[model samples]
Target: GSDGSPQWGTSAEDRDPPGGDRSNHTACPKQRTVHKCELLHVAIVCAGHNASRDVVTLVKSILFHRKNPLHFHFITDSVAHQILQTLFQSWMVPSVHVSFYNADDLKPEVSWIPNKHYSGIYGLMKLTLTKALPSNLSKVIVLDTDITFATDIAELWAVFGKFSEKQVIGLVENQSDWYLGNLWKNHKPWPALGRGFNTGVILLLLDRLRHLGWEQMWRLTAERELMNMLSTSLADQDIFNAVIKQDPSLVYRLPCFWNVQLSDHTRSEQCYTELSDLKVIHWNSPKKLRVKNKHVEFFRNLYLTFLEYDGNLLRRELFGCVRLTVTLPPTLQQALEELDEDDPCYDFRQQHLMQHRIHLFFLQYEFLALPNPTDVTLVAQLSMDRLQMLEAICKHWAGPISLALYMSDAEAQQFLRYAQASEVLSARRNVAYHIVYKEGQFYPINLLRNVALANTQTPYVFLTDIDFLPMYGLYDYLRNSIQQLELPQRKAALIVPAFETLHYRLTFPKSKAELLSMLDMGSLYTFRYHVWPKGHAPTDYAKWRTATVPYRVAWQPDFEPYVVVRRDCPKYDQRFVGFGWNKVSHIMELDAQEYELLVLPNAFMIHMPHAPSFDISKFRLSAGYRGCLQTLREEFHQDLSRRYGAAALKYLTAERSL
Candidate 1:
């Protein structure tokens, strides 16, 4: 190839076999001992709504072609983290390990760099990799979410052997003339060496970059460029190009076919002569797949192939008996036994949280097909003890239910056996079970709720607890009401009146009229009517007794009614764990977001009496637990005010005055 760069594409005979050793040609002394079986470290920055889907496709493409083990480091927001955690946990791919780092934690490092790109601050997260990742990691390959691979990634990893001592990064030349200032009149791009480099696929020598003080270098380059330009239009790419323009020897130019850019204005014809020669497809345009390229269909179909690939085939069991497990070291096990039993806050202490990892969707069972698609799904959470209630709930609801079950590693194994033997629980095709496990005493109540809510596929969801039994025909009633009430267009939450009974063995009510009779006879009462009147007072049971149509209810403090809301409503705040203020904080956010709460005329849910949760028992017995709950409540209100503004806090003030 010209310019001393490797050829864009090579025949099978010219390249090493898949996972073949190439340490003899290595240039960096630190990577000389690298073996073919070593885990390939890959970093990605994913945030926002659709990023998870794209990232899944990207990962699928890599898994399809790669032969070695993989370790993925995701820098993501809370939403993407939950979604991805649910997916990769259930995926159960052999030799794959995933780790998530909060994107908010890395924002401050690159927040000051103003970006004009559509991704905004998220596009600049790559700059923080040298500091965000652990110091022990020596090298990594960073990829953009909008990419698909057609060849084994080991070939790209092998490129590290070609890097000179002075070269700390490997990248392909930009396929467009955007950096040449030729796309439009008066165009001024950040400095570059000739055509500049595309960052979509990069080989990062982390140890080398750290030794060279990569952070300070890029910051200085960005500061110098900002003096002339208003802001960077390409985020990290612009700053990286400026730095490389100053020091040309710091980068090793990779084959252009590795990044065949499909942007609207891409000039990739000079990179590869045919679509078959391209190794990686990069849909860099905002209108991905729809971009104006002659070879768009070829790349689009490749991406679709991975997107729709059956993930079941990738499970570890398909190959052998390689099940995932969570085992603590002997030293950590001994340390946990020495914890003080008298400490009231021991369960939620920093030591416990630090030692345990919360595994989301540790085990999952999803229905591949259903006779009739459901309009509304019941989203609920429970522990292993409540697993028996699922059969009754599924029998009565007669619709889809997305359940998040919290359990230990042993309980998860027990659940699998229990589901197989129970006909109603296992044969019902509309129920999806997502199992979560964490080695801690306190329950992550809101975390479970958010996981269930995020995984729901229906247009609307009925948010409730596993202990509550819905009134018969509630699913059909809501399906009909959703059309007549125009619920699809309105920003509303249809409240379902709830009641509680102390008798463990009593006939469940079949209609609202039966429930009203039970209320009058004192066999049933509004849930927590006397103990916590403020909780359900906003529903106005007096008006609901004879009302035939939905009625609007004013927002009030401590109101937490089970309601059927659109699936895309605000997520529950995860900070409110261990029972107190969890559901109320979510209701308050719905109120703050201006969602109208309309009491449904027919729907009803009855809370069956059961043993109180561990968190509830602790709250009642421990003063320390109550104090922590109070502190969290105050912090939640303050955060709500900052998010939705002062006008949103007026509801709290109005409720207090009353």
Candidate 2:
């Protein structure tokens, strides 16, 4: 029931139909319950020429794609309002939602002080913060529209929703906990800001906001931070984090992938397949994303020309093969059915909202909002008989621990030749391993695990390889060993014991599916380079393995996988041509996850197959190297010639002075 309303809840029996529901407050008609929802809502903050181009491309992206039906709302500067509005409506669409006004229209200005203050926002994209949020958010999907939504908005709203216990207010509750660990100011860093958050994409929870006096919160934060600092790294993002973190009751947190963008570490596309339930794709200034190389354009071109990809994988990527079906609410259900019969937006406000509200209830509060927090179903198929073989992967198993899963296959007869060389390390272990095949790929089962990890459920996982030998009582000894270091977060789980002269990372407690995915994606890159350089393992690894029995789990964890600030995800500069050396991204993810690379004095793990077959005799990292250089150059244009030239050079040659 709506507390401030004229009674909103009904005690009817579930109102939900068998596999679908028609009684939703905003349900559509039946003829077509499935249609692309591409209506666009944009907040244009800057009006300079380049900003204009960005908006133009943004507008065309929405306009040119006829398959995606859309509506546009342009929030422009007061001075240029007239010209912008004309250009905005010039583009054809099913509808044009134009609100050409000054940033002053956002917050009420009772006097002259307010009007002059409006000019302040114009200084640096303040319209994004000054604009009045929608009072009626019934049909709005706030978008930068700078991105191409190869998928639909309706698909997102259909599968996802907010936490509706208190009437889900917003669809996205950002994961900004990671970077907030340390705060930065005027080139100086603060130890903490509680948690860092990105306010890129928001699924407005209007009615709830109105009821809870939500506008007051945004207004306050803006006045305090946006109006004060005017120079925070997160910008509007910082103000948003202040509002939500302080008021838990006002908003519900959505899952990790809902508004996926760049973390200081992760990229949206790289983790796209992993974030299974992603709905709205916030192409957050994608034109500016720091990718591999100038070749990052190659990826952009590939995405735009997705339909033109070559071969099977390219074709699958461009014209995605994702099968989708969504059940709409009664009003939308009705509107959809009558579209052929010509239904107008005459009663859109009242009827459309009623239906939208009901369906929104299911999407936000139930399944889609979060990843399967506790495993539900795997992507692969299995008979009911095989289901029992799959374990629940208990939550406790996910606690602070690192695990490493790797797979490898030698030409059947080749194993016989290496047996003699593999005898140095003696401990044996058993864990699940899946075999994947490709013509000439070095299938180190664990290489994929090394790459795809985003944020682990548990802090610690292993970094040991398949051909590696483990010291006896390794787990018991790790307990006493880690108790000695002062890692950033005492909760950190880095157990890279230097035993038997080999060192490996204790990465995290992950899912079997995750390990499988790591394998799947790893094969895509691992065959290009060596997983581990042959002679890198320490010769004194055995003695260290014997020395760790008396240590305790030490060190602090700087990154918290449980509550991440989405911006911390590692991003790949696409210009990176190839060692495909970019595979090192996996280590970066762990670093972002708060694991440190500990050079051991005496610890080690056994690597039965310690050679990287991928770094072939004719290895030419130049193309891949140049690709990386170009990506950095493009992403940080000025930095390429100044700040990052040296770093970029080193990245390309895998040497400091390259």
Candidate 3:
């Protein structure tokens, strides 16, 4: 076989090309087995032992959901044949008949074919189906192993009737723009070929394919460098497209829901909603098959359930219903337990955010349940480098604690891994980590804050950052302050000044009294009293809240740290990106809305010392972000002009009531 000689293969009498045949349906021979009564005939080409389980699971999914009789034909290697034989016998599902052919038999005929532009050996195997399958089968559905039928095989079979006389194949068009655009660029003559079809699902008329001798067309593409010139790894797909361009009427386009590609999230405009009538879901991307995100995890777990299906009572129950409830294997169970809860909020928020078509992508973290019922959810955004800071904050903040940790896309997985390993943090399931922005992109502080706030379920939320460590008893003080403000009908914000350590020695102060020793005696700053009230705006650092007790003042847009507000309060304006004027802009918005900003006399946090230059210039905002900030500045000025008539800009400084 390896010597490149022609092998024995089937040949049909009808010798017309594909589109020229309209009356060859009855030319196919009749079947010799009882499977001829089945209404659905599905064929799959699996390569080796690696895809053996995938093929078995796909077959199980089809058999589990179909009410009509079905027959399956598999073209695979010897190892897979052994695996499927054992799998079918163990499942005890006998209404179906599976006929397997050794794919090696076709190799002698295609052995001389070079794999220069070959995607995979499986692609080579697909081209042999016309000769390997029974001549009696007139129509069949070919599917990729890495897919599941969400609906019924009968529905997919119904698409065959919709195919016109000249349409020999029914398929779903590839909704991806990248592939279509590249195809257009390379093959400029066929700009009107339309979006090419994905070969994942196909309704084929085997008789027509054989009558037209279409296998030669596929072989010709490989021999003539038609696909090689295009530099496409999709060997079979390229050949199919080459033929489709010659005869556009040879394909019947099906709805995209029939072959929903999961990683095509970027092509959301072409994707179907969850509520749509989906018949098949193709896990086309190999990256997702490795289990990187929740969407992949969702499909992976379902695939596992299908693989281990034993036709037991639970399997029978799942056969009637699409859902299943079964205990996971011990090793997989432990692995998943180390992750966060499978929160549906990730899916819901993804759909919500993508509607805006913002460049931002959502990351999924496993969620831990709230440690204990508390009135507030403490939230912050940080990277993996700040684990020590987070641990220290968690040790000092003593209250019913629930946290939402937001990180960029690059470090979210690493930080989550660390959190899962930490005994002190993972001891309770309360923190939710969100990947709110792309890896290494300009950190959209306002957008992260809004995501954290929207996900917070508590009545009050304490918004702060990672580097700031709360002083002892700060949480208790805030909890008490919130109770006192409950009776007031007006919205309020509890503000606390943040102090930074002069050096690393003072960074880990042994006690609250030791840290408090640095605060000035007469409400004035000293060398040790490093009260940095700077939050993207100039602050009167010499002044202090000398009321000697908690008191309310007219709100000012200056403080950014240790602010506790009701959950119903307006959220931060997300348009302001980078470092300058973010939290202060929110404060100004609240001031204009007449919400009181309360100053707590004794409450403060010790900011951890880091590298030099913790200023606005340190964060170089991208050009896009600078543009966004400019737009916000204009909006703020326009609002001011509307309120105070041109001189309102001067009143920005005059309005500080504290």
Best by lDDT: 1
Candidate order by TM-score, decreasing, is 1, 3, 2
Provide the RMSD of all predictions against the true structure, rounded to 1 decimal.
Answer: 16.9, 25.3, 22.6
> Which has the greatest TM-score?
1
User: How well is each residue in 1-658 modelled by candidate 2, as lDDT tens digits?
Assistant: 1123232122233234577756754553332212233343444443432344345444443333333334445555442453355333322223334565455564343121122222243432332332254555442445443444333444334322324456433435444333444334544211223433345555554455566565566566556654544444444454455666566555545544656553333344543454334433444443454553323453455334422221112101112222222234466667556643232222221221221000000000111234322221111111122222123221112212212222112221122123223432111111111111121222222223322232133222344323333333343334334434443244333333321112234332143233234335542111112444222232222333345332332222111111111212343322222133332333333343444444433333323223334433224443543443344334433433264444334333332232
- Global lDDT for candidate 1? 0.80
lDDT of 1 by residue, 1-658 (tens): 2224443322234445457756765562222222335578999999854676578779878988766678899999886787687667655577788999999999989898889998899999998899999899988999999999998787787678667779998999998888998888999999999989999998999999999999999999898999988799998899889999999999999989889888878788678887667888888987887887777778888987886565444443213223333334667667667666666545554333333223343333343343233389999999987887888898789888888887654565478679868988768756766656554457888878887898777888999999999988999998887777888878999999999998898699888888899899999999998688889999999999999999999888889999888899999976666868889889999998889999999889888888888888888898988886766677777888889998677765855676
Candidate 1 deviant stretches above 4 angstroms:
1-34, 316-658
TM-score of each: 0.52, 0.35, 0.43
Candidate 1 TM-score, C-alpha based? 0.52
Give the Å shift of residue 141 in candidate 2. 2.1
Kindly report the root-mean-square deviation of model 1 from the true structure over all alpha carbons.
16.9
Candidate 3's TM-score: 0.43
The 10-residue segment of model 1 with minimum total lDDT is 28-37
